[model samples]
Target: MGFLPNSMLIMARKPGLVEAFAGLGLAVQGPSALPDEIKRMAAFMASRAAGCVYCQTHTHHQAANAGISADKLEALWDYETSDLFSEAERSALRVAQSAAQVPNAVTGADMSALKQHFSDEQIVDLVAVISLFGFLNRWNDTFATALEEEPSAHAAAHMAAHGWDAGKHAR
Candidate 1:
């Protein structure tokens, strides 16, 4: 990595915390049966729902790298009504949004809908992606981590039209 994120630098003050957090993050995001695009999309949506500008921009960049179309990414907040997403994608995004809510609003119907399209393992992966972003959302928001340049530029070019703002999180 050229420059470590501010969040990673802060976590580095406690090496064990950095190791454990990075390990879990790698494990959750590394090779898996779950398609990378879906995982990235879920992570992106979770970050959006959490209102973490740092994470939303980071995941949006990652999702673009993973080949998620700008159309799909832009339409994500309207996933339920958009034809850009498959039923499976919609289900997974719904799970991510619901689970990312402050009170953990995920419902049985959400799980049921997910089961209609994804295996238990895939469901676990979805939850893992959402849960990872939950940690990241809180970490970034609480630390007020400065937005890295690349993500900042990407957000301005691609996300500002969607109402994303750097706000207090801007470097």
Candidate 2:
């Protein structure tokens, strides 16, 4: 069901590339700096903006596993005044939103607001998260990858356990 010649299926043929993307994802969403939960939550929000249903479904599952509440998930789209998120989370979402909106409007005030809640290193990681989702959104949207679709249960299980580094993606 892809726009291109089965690009999703084709990506599976390159597990090394999948692994590489996962590494980047791990670096961005890993527990080393940014909280994996917050990273996944930001990804969910960006996926919504990108209209990538595949990313949304996968990230929704990931966010659930990370303990993101249903209330928070429901309010993610209008988080500016939502009481579900902490100040830190709101700031990160602001950054993610700016990045996801093509021709990003991330301003100095946005950066400053985010910086107040995160270290410089973590800010770098946050930007990486946004960038990754931007790439994922385009790929999923372009390929017309189906939501809830994956090559195999084994692949989904691996990715669920290992995060994006699990060597599987929609496109």
Q: Largest TM-score belongs to which candidate?
A: 1
CA lDDT, every model vs. true structure? 0.90, 0.69
Query: lDDT per residue, candidate 2, 22-68, as tens digits?
Result: 67766777665888767887887777667665666667766765677
Superposed Cα deviation of residue 16, candidate 2 (Å): 4.1
Write candidate 1's Cα lDDT for 63-166 as tens digits: 87778888988898789999999999888999899899989888999899999999999999989999999999999999988899987888999999889899
Which has the greatest lDDT? 1
- CA RMSD of all predictions: 1.2, 7.9
Candidate 2: deviation at residue 62, Å? 1.3
- Cα displacement (Å) at residue 169, model 1: 1.0
Candidate 2: segments with Cα more than 4 A from true spot = 1-9, 149-171
- TM value for model 2: 0.76
Residue-level error in angstroms, candidate 1, position 52: 0.9
